[model samples]
Target: MTVRPTDRLDETVGIDTSRPHPARMYDWYLGGKDNYPVDAEMGRQMLALDPRVPVMARVNRAFAHRATRWLTEHGVRQFLDIGTGIPTEPNLHQVAQAVAPDARVVYCDNDPVVPARAAALLRGTPQGATEYLLADVREPDVIIEGARQVLDLTRPVALSLVALLHLVPDEDGAHELVDGLLSQLPTGSYLMMTHATADFTPEESTAAVERLTAAGSTVALRSRTGFARFFAGLDLVEPGVAVVDRWHPELGEPVPGRDDGTIPGYGAVGRKP
Candidate 1:
């Protein structure tokens, strides 16, 4: 199904291209042309800190693909993907609908660029539905309300938060925001997440965070314990909380250089109740 564009181009105003945006930086890291020079410059700085930055991005994307396939196989037909970055290929709906063509997905992100390029994300199997919501993860009510238009909230919806929470700092009530989103999901709903962390290389992680923060982007690299806190009351899947690349590597092709060293991130899937 082709999801119609709900946002106008004028809504893309207020984009501060002088500074780097996470979504654009991610696009740059993935070798996409959607990012501007500022984003590429900041991405280069991040790579200087950790040369494996691009590899980590691929690993995280692979995890999202594997987790979505697993969820669809396990009977999840609805998905709410928050922090939807610049429309990368094989998006959440593409992965889920591949396994279950009838899957329904709602992609949400605070970045205006996403909505502007959302047409790439909206193409789904005719049996399924895909919609994009221009909202922030902190605004749980807004996300929920928008998601309901496409996904049946009472059904099992896999909330995909891959590579997002780390961008939200503690001062912003990150944990509270996650709890709020989970509270609205049904008992059988799932949370599929991949978060950047400082546990593997504190010095490099710290420097990267400092650079990003200085560039006007929030970087709250968490510890393994802190990442696990987001799934507190949920049931973790097997091989729980593995490094992003290590989580079900059999489910997808390995990201090049993933085995060279730790990826400095954690990924897991958890079911509510």
Candidate 2:
């Protein structure tokens, strides 16, 4: 179920062409035309550092699909997804609604371009509700308030950070932010995440981060142990914190370029005890 962007897209939604955005750059990685030349240029620079950047994007997305499916299959019917990029095929609502038609989803992102594309995200099943929030993850209160309008915080909700945290630096209190959000949910709620790491290729990863930072994009590559600490108190699922492709492989099709080398990212799902 591929989602089409709104025809009413306004390019002036605070979009900055002078610097690259992680969302638009991600769109480029997925081969979508939503990105600008600046984004493409930065993406090419990252590619030069590691030719598998695009492949890593696909692998990370595939991990999201698998984790969402796993949660919905386990009886989670509501979702609070922060940092949702351009609405790609089988958006969170679509994936959840496929398993449970009444699933409700609230997507939040600070990206100016994301709200402009909310039309596609809103096209969920009649039995469910899908809403997008034009807010940043740093403002947890704002995101939670917006999400409360669409989801029942009293019930179990999957808080999907996905690939968003690596962009948030420790100086920003990344762990504190996660804790603040989790505090608002019930005991049965879950956290689904994937983040880029320097554990595998420290040298190239450092250079890539420097380049992206020079381009005005914030990048904070963490260690494998650092990634594991995000799920500190929660109970991890089986085969914990493996490379994106190695987690629950039976849930999705194979992504290309995975066998070449370490994918430089990690994905995992953890439940609040």
Candidate 3:
């Protein structure tokens, strides 16, 4: 069965189309029509600085798909995907449930636009369950509490933070928030994540951060070491902390233009022992 957001969610947390949202900007990058003019404007600026922005987005998404498949094949039956953006084809639930029909998934995102199109995220196999929570990652307790409605807190759950933490700067206790969520899961649970980094092109990355900050969005691109810090205390899977597309390329198709230049992102899956 599918669990949905409350009807009052949209009214209470109104979509602020006046400013550009990261999720909408991401959608625009993916060639989706869910973004506004402001989002497109910022996206264009990002493209101008690095035309690989769209390719990076696709590479990040592909990482999520491949990571999901790997987790399911390895016996994971539950997933808690935070920072889920606009519903695109073959969402986390689709990939997981396809591999294991009984897989259960709980997707959480702060974007108001997500709740509007969350139904697209909730569709899953009859043997599985899919749910959406209209909440922010900053409030780990809220996300955990909501997820409890659908997932078993006592069991192992894959905590997915794809393209998310970069938006959460240090002042927000990004690392602390991640630890808080992982602390609630079982020992065998996993942390599957992808973070955009400035390790490859510091100058361009710094400029991109400035543009997003000016537009009311936060972008804290981490270095390779900083990106790996999120997985501290966990055992990283093989080919650990690799460039986005380099991680398990055998599991999915390559993103076009991936080899054209550096993707400037890190992706990995780590198991909590």
Candidate 4:
């Protein structure tokens, strides 16, 4: 059953479609129809900054898929996927449920568009349970609380924050927010994430960030070192913290255009113990 967020929460929600939202822009990149003209205009500007933008998006999604597969295959049955963009096909739940039919997934995102079409994300295998929570990463308590309704926090759960933290600046305490959430999970839990960075192409990255910021979608591109801090104290998996496209390429098929050139993003998976 698709539970409307407005029904889940007592407060009335408002969606402002006049401005470009990151989730909608990402949908535009993935060739989804849930975006408006504002999203396309901003997406085009990003393309002008770097034509590989779409390729990078595909690579990021590939990494998330591979990581989810890896975790499920390794005995992780519960998932808390924050920053889940639009309802793209083969969503996190679908990938995990394919590997382990009983896998349970909780998808979270602040975007109003996501909740509107969240029914697509909730459809999973008969043996598994899938739920969507209309919440933001910044409010860890709200997310964690909502997730407990569908997930077991006492057991090991893979926390997926792929391609999310870049939109959250340091002033917002991105690091603190991650640590705060992980602090509540069991020792065997994991954190899987990918973040955009300025390390590869400084000039283009800076300009892109400026445009995104001006359009109300702030991008705080991190360096390699900054990205590593998110995993502080956790044991990073083998071949730790490599570039998004380069991490465990043998684990999955190569994205068509991902190898053409460098994609400015960092990806890593860490175990709580």
Candidate 5:
């Protein structure tokens, strides 16, 4: 693993490397070196269950890219990306700003490790503005407030919850939180999301969920119906809610093995009409 420069994060922040965090494990899956042994161990177990787990992560990320590109092309100049994960190359802002140089983006993640390397995230074009917020999605008020600093809440902003909702169970009021955040935005704002699901591989997905919950990470993989409910009252884009690979594949390259194996996820883009 290549040793990338750490961002020399704030010392007061709390980061527990003792247990595996979803962000770190996700980084590990993406062939990044930011994760610890605990994260790799859990990721290995997940891979053992389904060797295509890494492919699923990549597919979900690709969905985010295509959705961001579509939103930018559709004239969305502001973005609020929660569960922004580690600072992967060609991030949401990269994809958006590539189309609109002045795009403003707010990236939020619960992981301190991500902020530890947020400098890479801040390296956007001078015409654009990018900021990282260390907050949890369960608290939408805090996220919305922090996002307002960089993004104009009155404008049409794309609220991206890509590969995030599974971490927040229904008991945690995930639907209510999304509604609250959307309530703060204006009409024509978009909601772009990709979620893990058990509809394809029920038995394996359930086992993976149990294992993740056992390791202190909640994986509330939703079904097609449950995932669609998040966009209730909003106008779904063409093709409606579909699998990650099926949602606007023309906008981005397809992930290998995404179809050979069940991706176990749903991706969609909706306009707040």
Candidate 6:
């Protein structure tokens, strides 16, 4: 059943054009036209340091797609994707429902601009459902409640935090927030994540984080061990917490430039036992 879009908030959340937002900046990196000049400027700065910034974005996006397909093929029919950025084609629901036509998806993002383009998010198969929630990942309670409206909490759901948690610093209770949200899911539910890491290119990654922080954007590129802690209680899928591109590359197309330089991120999927 197609879900009729609902207006949850009465006021339109204003988009801040002065500073760079991760979503818009990411869009800029992906060569999408939905970003502002300010976002492009920051994206340019990121590219200057690592010319493969766009490749990294694509690699991260590809992982999200493959993970969704993997989960749906494994019998999952509901998804809760938080930290979902601007609507990109072949979105989580589109990928999941392509395999499981009756899949239900709820996408949440803190960016105010996301809601304005939420229509792109709602366009899923007629047999499937997609809904966007204007909420922050930091507030897991609010996100869970919003997701509950469309997804059955008793059934297994794949929670995707792809290419997003790195934008949230540990000081913001990032780990705790993930745990809180996962606690709401039933056993057999899965945690699919891709986190940027400084493990490979420490100098460049550190400098990138500093530059983003100066512009009011934060990037917390965690170490391999730090990223794994996010799935402590869960059983990790095979190829435990490898580099983003290295994890299940056989499952998806190889990202160009992925091997030429360091991808600078880790990706993994874990199941709640």
List the candidates ranked by TM-score, beginning with the highest: 3, 6, 1, 4, 5, 2
- Candidate 2 per-residue C-alpha lDDT over 225-257 given as tens digits, one digit per residue, 9 for 90 to 100: 999989999999988989878899899888876
Give the per-residue Cα lDDT of candidate 3 at 256.
Answer: 75
> Which segments of candidate 4 are over 4 A away from where they belong?
1-6, 9-11
Tens digit of per-residue lDDT, candidate 6, span 164-200: 9998889998999999989999999999999988888
lDDT of 5 at 234: 97
Q: In terms of TM-score, which candidate is stronger, 2 or 6? A: 6
lDDT on C-alpha atoms for all candidate structures = 0.87, 0.86, 0.90, 0.88, 0.86, 0.86
For residue 37, give model 5's deviation from the true position in Å: 0.7
- Please state the error at residue 197 of candidate 1 in Å: 1.0
Question: Ten-residue segment with the worst summed lDDT in candidate 1?
Answer: 4-13
Candidate 1 per-residue C-alpha lDDT over 131-237 given as tens digits, one digit per residue, 9 for 90 to 100: 88888888899889878777787787898999999999999999999889988989999999999999989999889888888888898899999999998989999
Global CA lDDT of candidate 4, please?
Answer: 0.88
Error of 3 at 140 (Å): 0.4
Question: What C-alpha root-mean-square deviation, in Å, does candidate 1 show against the real structure?
Answer: 1.5
Indicate whether candidate 1 or candidate 6 has the larger lDDT: 1
Which pairs clash in model 3? Answer: none
Worst 10 residues of 4 by lDDT: 1-10
Off by over 4 Å in 6: none
Q: Candidate 4 residues 1-273, lDDT tens each?
A: 322343454446787787899889999998999999999999999999999888888999999999999999999999999999998877898899889989988888897778668754458777788887889999999999988887889999999999999999999999999999999899999999999999989999989988988888878899999999999999999789999988888877878766566789999999999
Clashes counted in candidate 4 amount to 0
> What local lDDT score does residue 242 receive in model 4, on the 0 to 100 scale?
93
Q: Which of 3 and 4 is ahead in lDDT? A: 3
- Give candidate 1's whole-model lDDT: 0.87
TM-scores for the candidates:
0.96, 0.94, 0.97, 0.96, 0.94, 0.96
